[model samples]
Target chain A: MKDERTVPARTATQVKIADAAIRVIAQRGFDVVSVRSVAQQSGLSAGTVQYHYRTRQDLLLAALERSVARQAERIRTVGRVESYRESMALTLRELLPLDGVRYEDAAVWVSYGAAAATRDWLAGPYWSGMRLFHDGVRETLERARADGRLREGLTPETAAPLVTALVNGLTLDHLNAPARVRVEVEAALDRGLRLILRD
Target chain B: MKDERTVPARTATQVKIADAAIRVIAQRGFDVVSVRSVAQQSGLSAGTVQYHYRTRQDLLLAALERSVARQAERIRTVGRVESYRESMALTLRELLPLDGVRYEDAAVWVSYGAAAATRDWLAGPYWSGMRLFHDGVRETLERARADGRLREGLTPETAAPLVTALVNGLTLDHLNAPARVRVEVEAALDRGLRLILRD
Candidate 1:
C-alpha cells in the first residue's frame, strides 16, 4: 500500500506553484486561492498548475507543509539555550508577526483557522501545527521550572497552554493593528513571561 | 450634513437579508458571501436583496451592526456586579464560542480579522469593535482594583489589554479545536484572570 505519510517528490514546477499559492493566499485572502489564480500568479498555464496540485486543497496542503517546515526549523535553531527565559522569548516571538514574511505567514494561518472552522478535513493539520507549538511552550516552561528560573508555585503543565493562547491572541491583535500593537508587542510578551519567569 | 453614526432605519426586507448574510458567513465562510448567496440563503429574489443592500459590504455591515448591537446588549446586561472576578468571567465568557450563536459570532469576527489584514476600509471597523471590547475590560479591571479585589502588583492598564488578547487567543483555539479546548476553556480563562484578579 502507498504510504499516506510520505510526501511525493516535488518537481521545480510544483515548488513554483506552491510558492505562488502562498503568495496568493497572503495577498488576497484564502477565499480567492484557486488553481487558476495560482497559475496566473506563477505565470504558468492552468493545466501545468493542475498537473501538480489537482485541487485547491492540494495546493494549500503543499504550501502549509513548506511553511510548517520553515517554522519548525526556526524554532529548532532557538532550542537548547542556557536561559529558558531568553529561549522562551525567542521561540514564542518566532511565532509572532514581527516582520513582513512572518506577517504573511500569520495571515495565512489566521485565514486558514477561519476557513477550517467548517472544513473538518482541514482541522487535523490546524490542530497538528497548534499542538506542536503548544508542546514547545510546555517544554520551555518545564525547562525553566527545572532550572529554577520559573517563579515558584507555578507548574509547566498549567501555564504552558495558557502562554500559547496568549501568543495566539497577541499575534491576532498585531496582524490586525500593527501600528498600535507594534510598540507594545515585545513589552507585552515580557510582561506575560514575567508572570511565571524569574526576574 | 448627514449623521454618519446614526444607523438608517432598516425595513423588514433588510433585516431578513442581514440575518441571511450572517447565516451564510457562519455556514459557508465569508468568501462565499455575496448578494446572490445572501439572497439565496434568505429565499429572496436577487433583485429584492440588491434593492435593500446595494453591495456585499452593505449587507455585511448591516449584519455586523446587528451582531454588534446584540453582543453589546448582552455584555451590557452583565455590566455591574458585586464581584469583579465573577463579572469578568461572565463578560469574557459572553465572547467565547460556548454555543451555536456565539460560535457563529466568533467565526465571523475571526474571519473579518483575517480579511481586514489587507483591506484598509475593513480595518477601521475591526479595530473599532476590538477597541470597544478592550475599553470595557480596562474599566472592569479598574473597578476590581478600586474594590481591592485585584491581585497586587498589577495595573488595569497593563493587564487589561493582555487579558483581551488572552481571550481572543482562547476563542481562536476553541473555535478550531472545540472538543480539545472545550474542557479546558473555562479553566484557562480563570488561570489567566487569576494572574491579575484576587481569589
Candidate 2:
C-alpha cells in the first residue's frame, strides 16, 4: 500500500507543475486539465510542463501522488492526543477538507474518483491511497486499544473500515454541499466517532 | 425535495434519449456523454435527439431526472416490513447498484457527482436526489421509531444523516472497487445499521 508509485515530487519544476494540475482540477475540474492549461496556470510554457509530466495522465498522477503523500506525512508527524475521541478527531479531521490545501486534494480525489469509475489506470493510485489510509486508521485504533482507550467488544479490524467510510462519506457530502457541510464536518466527524466508540 | 426539476420523461423519444444517455454515462463515463453519442447509442439521428433534448446539459438532466424519479417511485411504492432493520435494509439497498438499471443510476450519480464538484448546473439534480433520498431514509427511521424497533435515545433527526452518509460512502467505495466491495456492500450496510439501531 505504501509503495504504489508514492513518489514525491522529484524536482521544484515537477512540484510546480503538479500544483498547477491541482489548481486546474480544483478550479475548472479534471476534464479541462490539459497540459496547456496547467502550464498556463503555473506560468510555464506547455513544453516545460510537458517535459516534466510527459502526458496529462502523468500530471494528474503527480497531483494525486503529492496530495496523498502530504496527508500521510501530516498524519505521520502528529503528536498523540489524550483520549480515543481526540485521537480520532485529529486523525479523521486530517482526512476531511478543513482547509484550502486539503480541500483541493479532496477535490482532486473526488473528481478523479468519479471519472475513474470507467477509467482503470486512474483508479490504481486511488486504491493505494485508500489502502494506506485504511491501514493508518486501523493502526490508530490499535493504539487506542493498547492504551486502554477502546471500548470492550470493539476491535480495530472491524472499526477501521467504518471510520474510513464515515470519513469518505463526510468528505463526499462536503464536496457536494460545502456551504452547509463545511461547518458541520468536524461535528459530524465527532458524531460518527461517538457512534463508533460509544464515547 | 421532490419538486426540484424532478420532471420525468415527457415523451417516448425523450425517454429513449434519456436511457441512451444513461447507457453512455454508464458505459463510457459522463465526460464522453454527448448528444451525438447518445443518438448513436439510441439508433437515432443527431437531429432527432436534438429535437427532443436540445443540448448536452439538457440531455444529461433528462437522464438524471429519469433515474432519480425511478428510484424515488420504486421506494415510494414499497410494502411495509417487519422491523427497522428490514425497512432500512430494503430502502438503502434500493439506493445501491445491485442490478443493471440501478447500476446505471449509481454510475450516473457517482460520475456526475464527481464532475459536479466543479459544474454548478450539473449538481442541481444531484442535490435534489440527495434530499429526496435523505427524506426517504429519515421516514424509514421514523417508522422504525413508531414501531418500537429503534433503540432508546436514537432519534430520526440524528440517525438520518448518518444513515445517508453510510449509504453514500458504500456507493463511493463500490464505484472505486467494485469487485471487492460489491459483495460487501450489503454486509457493510447491515453492520452500519446495527451500529445505529443495536439490532
Candidate 3:
C-alpha cells in the first residue's frame, strides 16, 4: 500500500529539484547545469537529485514544463472585472522578465531554447509550448473580433504569430536591458494591442 | 622585407578560419564550439588555427564581428528604385534565416545570443549589434514617417522596437520550425508592418 504522505513529499522534492535546476541555468549557462550543481543548489545529496532527475536533460525538461505550466495558468483565468484587452496585457506581461522570478524563467527559457535548436528530442516540447501560447493569443484575438473590438481586416490567424513573436523578442530585449522601463514595454504592448483591437 | 604575398594569404586564411567557426556554431550547439572543432571544420591544423585565433573567445568575437559586418552591409546600400517601405522590408529580411547562408547566419546568431545571455563580456557585442539593428529599423520607420507613409498615431520611436522584436522572435521561431512555410512567415511580417504603416 502506498503511503499518503509519500506522494506529497515526492512531489515537493521534485519541485525543489526543478526550481534548483532553473536557478542554476539562470545563473550559469546551460552547459553548467548538471546533477551535481542542481543537487548543491537544492541542498540535497547528488544521489537524491539523480533519483528524481537522472540526467541534466531530465532536470531541464522538468524546469521547462513547470515554467510553461505556470505561465499558462497565469493566462487561464481571466478576471471577472478585467476586460479581454486588459486580461491579455496582464497575460503577456507574465511572460516578460519584469521581476526576479520571471527574469530567471526567461533566462532558463533562452538557454533551453538554444539547446533545443540543435537537439531534436527537446524540440517537441519547445514547439508545443510555443504553439499553446500562440493559440491562446489567437483565441483572445478571435474573441475580440467576435465582440467587434478587433479592427477590420485583421484575422486572429494572421495576428497571433506576430503577438507571439513580439512577446519573445521583447523578452530577449528585456533580458539584456534589465533596467529598461516597464512602462515603455507596456506602452509598446498597449500600442500594439490597440492597433489590432479598437478602443 | 616580409613577403607582400603573405599578407593576402594570411588574411584569406583568417577569413576561412572565421567562417569555419560560424559553420561549427551553426551545425553544433554553442557548447560544442571549441578551438579544435573549428580547426577541423576549416580543414586547417589546430596549430594554424590557434596561431591566429589564440583563444575560443577571440575566434567567437571575430566571427560575430564578421557576421555583424556582413549584415550591416546588406542594409547599407538601399537602391534608389526601392521605396522606403520596400527598403525597410529588404533590410529586415536580411536578418531572417530565409536561405542556406542566412540560415547559417541565424543559427550562429542564436547560439551566440544564448551564450551572451550568461556571459558579461558577450553582453556588450550582443547588445550593441541589437541596438544597431534597432536603430536601423527606427531610421527606416522615420524615413517612412517623414514621407507621410506611416499610420496615424504611430511614431517611429514607438514602432521600431516592435519591428526589431518581431524579427528577433521570428528568427528564433524559424530556427526551431525550419519546415514552417516561408509565405506564412512573410504574410505575418507583411500584416504586422501594414498594421503600423499606412497602406
Candidate 4:
C-alpha cells in the first residue's frame, strides 16, 4: 500500500488536472466537479484527464489529499516556540480564509466536509484532515500546560475541541460573509483562545 | 410577489415533493437535490413538481423555509422561565441534533449552508435561518442583561457569535460522529455557555 505520509508522485499532466479539480471545487462547489470540467479548466482533453484519474472520486481525492498535505505543512512550520499562546494564535489564524487563496481552500474543505456527511467513502479524507488539525491543537495546548502557560484548571483534551470548533465555525462564517473584516475574525479567535488559555 | 414569512399553501402533491426534497437532502446531501430526483422520490412527475416551484431554488427554498419555521417554533415554545440561564439552556438545546429527525434537520442545514457558499441565490435561506437563530441567542442574552443574570464583562454582541459558533461547531461534530452521545453534546454547550454567562 502507498504510504499516506508521503506525497504520491504525479506527472505534470496529473498535477495540472489536480490543480484544475481544486479550482473547480473551490469555484463551483464539489458536487459539480467532474473529469470533463477539470479537463476543460486545465486546457487538456477529457481522455487525458481520465487517464490521470480513472474516476471522479480519484480526481477529487487527489485534490483533497494535496490540500490536506499543504495545510499540514503550514501547521508544521510553527515549530517549538517560547509561547504556545502566540504559536497557537499564529497557526490557527493561518487556517482562516482571510484572502483569496485561503478562501478557496476553506471553500473546498467545506464542500468536501458537506459531501462527506452522507457519503461514507469520502469520510476518510475528511476525518483524517480533521484529526491532524485537532491533534495539532491538542499538542499546542499540551505544550502550554507543560510550560505552565496554560490556565491552571484547563487540560489539552478539553480545550482542543473548543479551539477546533471555533476555527471551523469562524472559517465557515468568513467564507459566507466576504464582507467580514479581518480584524473581527482575528478578534473572535483571540477571544476564544483567551477563554481557554491563561491571561 | 410572495411574502416570504407566509408559508405558501401547498397541495398535497407539493407537500409530498417538498418532504421528498428534505429526505433527499438529509440522506444524499443537498447537491443532488433537483426537481427530477425529488419527483422520483415523491412518486410525482417532474412537470408537476416544476409547476408548483417554478425553479429548483423555489422548491429547495420552500423546504428550507419550512424547516426553519419549525425550528423557530420549537425554540419559541421554551416559554417563560425563572432565570435567563434556564431559559437560554432550554432554548439552545432545541437546536442540537440529538434525535434522528433533529439530526436530519441539522445535516440539511449544514449541507445547504455549504452549497450556499458558492450559490448566491441560496444565500437567502442560509442567512435568514442564521439570523433567526443568532437573534434568538442575542435576545436571550439581552434578557439576561436586563435581569442582571449576565456576567459583568459580557456583551450580547460579542457573546452571540461565540454561542452561535459553538452550537454550529458542535452540530457539525455530532453529525460527523453519529455515535456521539447526547450528554456529551449537551455538556459541551453547557461549558460554552458557562464561559459566556454568569452563574
- lDDT string for model 3 (A1-199, tens) is 7533212113878878877877887788788889899899999999988887777677778888877776777667635334666777777877776676677787766666677878987888888888888888899899888888777778888878888888887777667763654447777776777777775
Query: lDDT (0-100) at residue B186 of candidate 4?
Result: 76
Give per-residue CA lDDT, model 4, range A1-199, as digits (tens).
7643213316666667777887888788887788889888899999888776778888878888767766677767856555667678788877777766566677777777778878897776778888888888898788788877776456788777778878877776656653643358887887777777763
After TM-score superposition, the amount by which residue A47's alpha carbon in candidate 2 deviates from its true location, in angstroms, is: 1.5
- Which DockQ value does candidate 1 get? 0.70
Badly placed stretches (over 4 Å) of model 1 are A1-16, A43-48, A79-81, B1-13, B178-180
How many clashing residue pairs are found in candidate 4?
Answer: 0
Off by over 4 Å in 2: A1-8, A147-154, B1-8, B77-79
Error of 1 at A113 (Å): 0.6
Question: How accurate locally, in lDDT, is each candidate?
Answer: 0.77, 0.77, 0.75, 0.74
Error of 2 at B199 (Å): 3.4
Rank by TM-score (best first): 2, 3, 1, 4
In model 3, which regions exceed 4 Å deviation? A1-10, A77-82, A181-183, B1-10, B77-82, B181-183
Residue A163 in model 2: shift from native, Å? Answer: 1.3
Provide i-RMS per model in Å.
Answer: 1.1, 1.3, 1.3, 1.3
Q: Which has the better DockQ: candidate 3, or candidate 4?
A: 3
* Cα RMSD (angstroms) for every candidate in the order listed: 3.0, 3.9, 4.0, 3.4
lDDT tens digits by residue: candidate 1, B24-131: 887888878898999899999999877777777777777766666556778888765666787788778877777776777878778877888767767787888888
TM-score per prediction, in order, is 0.90, 0.91, 0.90, 0.88
